[model samples]
Target: MWASSARIYAVALKEIKQLSRDRVTFAMIVMIPLVQLILFGYAINTDARHIPAGVVDYTQNQTSRALILAIEATQAVNFQHHYYSPQEATDAIIRGDIKAVLILPHDLERRIALRSNRLTQDSARLLNEPIGQWLVDGSDTLIAATVRSLRTMPLNDVTQSALPQTPVTFEVVQWFNPEQRSVVNIVPGLLAIILTMTMILFTSAAIVREREQGNMEFLINTPIRPFELMLGKITPYVFAGLIQVSIILLVGHLLFSVPIRGGLLSLFGAALLFIFASLTLGLVISTIAKTQLQAMQLTVFILLPSILLSGFMFPYQAMPEPAQWIAEGLPATHFIRMVRAIVLREADFLVLQQDALWLVAFTLLGILLASVRFKKKLS
Candidate 1:
C-alpha cells in the first residue's frame, strides 16, 4: 500500500513538471479565471447608464431646458448632441451616433403650462395630449428598456410639479422592435457568436492536430503550396459554417419566433463572407499554436473579447471608446450588426454594404496573414 501511494505521488509530480513546461497551459490555468472576473465585474452593467441621446429641443425655452437638465441629472442619459430638427436626430440614430432621440414639440412649454392650468379645471380633457416624443433605437433590447425607465424618472418629476395628479405623456416610439422582445435581439446575435465560437475553435485545432499527429510533416512534403493547402483546409469548413447558420436561423425562427425581415439572399451572402473570415482567423490562430491545447487556449482568448466586446450581451455605445475600436476590428462585431440589421430591421443589401465590405476585408486579411505564417516545410 505504501509503494502504491508512492507511485501515485510520482505520477502526480510528473504531471506537475509537464504542466510547468507547457507555458501556454500554465498561463491559461492562471489567467482564465482572473480575466473572467475582471471582464464580468467591470465590463458588464445591467443598469446601463449614460446612454448617448440626441435632443431636438424645438422649444428651447426654460421648460425644455429644465426637462433636459432633469434627464441629464438622472445619470441615465447623456444628451451629447443637440439637433435643430427631428430629421437630424433620426439621421444620428441611424448612423449609430446615439441610442435615442428626444424631440420636444414647438408648443411643448405652452402645452405643459396649459395642461397645468387645465389640470385644476378638468383632467380628463388633457389626458390624451402628448408633451413630446422619445424615439428609441430598439435594436438592443437592454438599452431600449433602460432608456424607457430613464425617460420615466425625469418625466414623472416634471409632470408632478406641473400637474400634480396628471402624468406627463410622451409618444414613446421604439423603432425596429416596438414590442422590445429580448429574443428578437438575442437570437440574431447568437448566430454571430455560434459561428465565431465554432469556426475559430474548429479551425484552430486543424493544423495543430495535424502537426501533433505528424500528418503535417507528410503534407509538407507534398507538391501543394502553403496557400493552396490552407485554402483546401478552409474550404470544407465554409460549408460547415453555412450549415451552422442555416440550422441556427431555422431553430431561432421556429423556437423563438425571431423574424427574418430582410432579404434571404442578402443575408446568406453576407454570412458567407463572415464564415470565410472566421475560418481564416482560425487558420491564423492554428499557425501560431504548436499544439492542440495551445490552439484551444488562443481560441478562448479570442472568443472572450468576441463575446464581451462584440455587443452580444451589452450595447457597444455604452463601452469606452478604446473597447469600441477593438470591437470594430473583430469580425464577430460586424457580423452581429449585419445579422441584427437583416433579421430585426429588414435592412437590404444597400443598408448592409459597409458591414459586408468589412467582412470581405477581414477575410482577405486573415487569409493573407495565415498564408504568410503557414510554411511549406514543417516548422
Candidate 2:
C-alpha cells in the first residue's frame, strides 16, 4: 500500500511539473477566465445608450427644442445632427451614420393644443393622432428598443400632464426591420462569428499540429515554397468554411425564419474573401505559436474581441472610439456589417463596394503577413 501511494504521488508531481513547463497552457488556464470575466463584465452592454441620432424639427419651435432636450436628457440618444428635411435624416440612417431620427411634425404644437383641449371628451382620439415620427434603424434591435423607450417618455409625460388622462402617439417607423425580430439581426451576424472562430481555429491548429508531429520539418525540406504551402493549407479550409456557412444559413432560415433579402451571389463573394482572410490570419497565428495549445489560446484571444468588438453582440457605435478603431481593423467587423446589410437591408454589390474592398485588402494583408511569418519561423 505504501509503494502504490508513492508511485501515485510521483505521477501527480510529474504531471504538475510538465504543466508548469508548458507556460502557454498554464497561462491560458489561469488567464482565460480572468480575461472573459473582465471583457464580458466591463465591455458587453445590452442596454444601448448614447445612440447617435438626427433630428428633423420642422416646427423648430421652443416646444420641439424642449422635446429634443428631454429625449437627450433620457441619456439614450445623442443628437448629433439637426437636419432640415426628413430625407436628410433618413439618408443618414441608411448610411449608418445614425441609429435613430426624430422628426417633429410642422403642426406638432397646434396638434397638441387641439388634442389637449378635446382630451376630456375624446382621450382615445388623441392617441390616434401622429404627433411626430421616430425613424429607427431597427436593424439593431437593442438600439431600436432603447430609442423607442426614450422617445416615448417625453411625449407620454407631456400628454399626461396637459390632459391628465390621454396618451400621445408617435409613428415609430423601423426602417429595415419593421417587426424588430432579433433573428433578422442576429442570424446574419452569427455567420461572421462562426466563420471567424472555426476558420481561425482549424488553420491555426493545422500548421501547429504538423510542426508538433515533425511533419512541418519534412514539408520545409520539400520543394514547395512557403507561400504556396500556406495557400495549400488554407485552400481546403475555404470549402469547409463555405460548407459551414451554408449549413448555418439554412438552419437560420429553417429554424429562425431569418430572411435572406439580398443577392446570394454578393453574400457568397463577400463570405469567400472573409474566409480567406480568417484562414490566413490563423496561419499567421500558427507561425507565432510553438504548439497547438498556444495557437488555440491566441485564436481565442482574437475571437473574443471579434465577438465583442466586431458589433456581434453589441452596437459598434456604442463602444468607445478607440474600440471602434480596433473593430474597424478586424475582418469580422467588416464581414458582420456586410452580412447585415445584405441579409437585412438587401444591399447590393454596388452599395457594399467599400466593405468588399476592405475584405479584399484584409485577405491580401493576411496572406502577406502569413507568408512572411511562415518564412521567418521556418528559417
Candidate 3:
C-alpha cells in the first residue's frame, strides 16, 4: 500500500508538470470559465431595453410627437427611423433593420378627441379604438413579448388627454410566427447551431488527427499542396453539412410544423455558403490547434459566443453593442439571420443579399487563412 501510494504521487506530479508545459490547454482551462462568467453575467440580458424600433407618423401633431416621446421615455424602445409609410416600415422589419414599427394613423388627434369627448354620446367602440398599432418581428419571441407589453398601455401622462383606464395605445401585430411558437424560432436557429458544431468540429481536428495518427510525415513527402489538402478535407464535410441541413429542416417541418417558406434554391445557396465558411474556419483551427483536445477547446470557445450572441438562445438586440459586434464576427450569427429570414419571413433572396455576400467573403478569407497557415506549418 505504501508503494502504491508512492507510484500514485509520482504519476500526479508528472501530470502537473506536463499540464504546466501545455500552454494552450492551460489557457483554455482558465479562459473558458472566465469567458463564460463574463458572458452570462454581463452580456446576456432577458429584459431587453432600448430595442430598435421605427415610426410611421401621419399625425405629425402634438399627440403623435408626445406619444413617440412617451414611448421613448419608457426605455422599452428607441425609434431610430421615421418611415413615410407602413409599407416602408414593413420592409425595414423584413430587412431586420428594426424590430417593431409604431404606426400612427392620420386621424390620431381626432380619435383622442373622441376619447375625451364624453359630452356627446359617441360610440364606445370609436373611443376604445387603439390610438396606434405595432408591426413586430415575432421571429424573436422575447422581442415580440417586449413590444407586446406596450399594447393597451396608458400614455395619458404624455398624451395629456383623458384616456380610458385600459387604453390600448398600440396594438401589436406579430409579423412572422404570429402564434409566437418558440419552436418556430428554435427550429431554424438549430440549423445554425448544429451546422456550426458539426462542420467546424469535423475539420478542426483534420490536420491534428493526421499528425497524431502518423500520416503527416507521409503527406509531407507528397506533391499535394496545402490549399489542395485543405480543400480535400472540406469537400466531404460540405456534403455532410448539406445532409444535416436537409434532415433538420425536413424534420422540423414535419414534426413541429415549422414552415420552410423561402425558395429552396436560395435556402440551399445560403446553407452552402455557411457550410463552406464553417468548414474552412475549422481548417484554420486545425492549423492553430496542436491536438484534438485543444481543437475541441477552441471550438467550445467559439460555440458559447455563437449560441449566446447569434440570437439563438437570447434576443440579439437585447445584447449590448459590444456583444453584438463580437457576435457579428461568428459565422453562425450570419447563418441564423439568413435561416430565420428565409424560413419564417419568406424574405426575398435579394433582400438578404448583403448577408449572403458577407458569408461569401468570410468563406474566402477563411480558406486563405487556413491555406497560408497550413503551408507555414508544413514548411
Report, for every candidate in turn, its global Cα lDDT versus the true structure.
Answer: 0.82, 0.82, 0.87
Q: Of models 1 and 2, which has the larger TM-score?
A: 1
What TM-score fits each model?
0.87, 0.86, 0.95
lDDT of 3 by residue, 1-379 (tens): 9999999999999999999998889999999999999899988999878999999999898778987888888899999999999999988888778999999998887777666554566636676678788999998899999998888656475556564544546678998889989999999999999999998999998778888887888887889998899898899999999999999999999999998888888788889999999998899889888899999999998888889889999988788999989998998999888888888888777888888899999999998988888852343
Q: How many residue pairs clash (N, CA or C atoms closer than 3 angstroms) in each of the candidate models, in the order given? A: 0, 0, 0
Residues 1-379, candidate 1: write the lDDT tens digits. 9999999999999999999999888888888888788667766666667898999987887778887888788787899999999888876676566889998888886667665556454445665677888999887888888777754433445654643544566777899888778888888888888888899889989988888888977886779887898899988888999998899899998998888888888788878988999999999999888898899898898888889989998887667777778889999999888778777766666666788899898888888999998886666
Q: Mind giving the per-residue lDDT tens digits that candidate 2 earns over 191-245?
A: 9999988999999999888877878677867789878988999999999999998
Pick the winner on lDDT between candidates 2 and 3.
3
Alpha-carbon runs more than 4 Å astray in model 2: 115-128, 155-168, 317-326, 376-379
Q: What residue pairs clash in candidate 1, if any at all?
A: none
Which structure among the candidates has the greatest TM-score? 3
Q: How are the candidates ranked when ordered by lDDT, highest leading?
A: 3, 2, 1
Candidate 2: 10-residue stretch with minimal lDDT:
151-160
**Position 318, candidate 3: lDDT:** 81
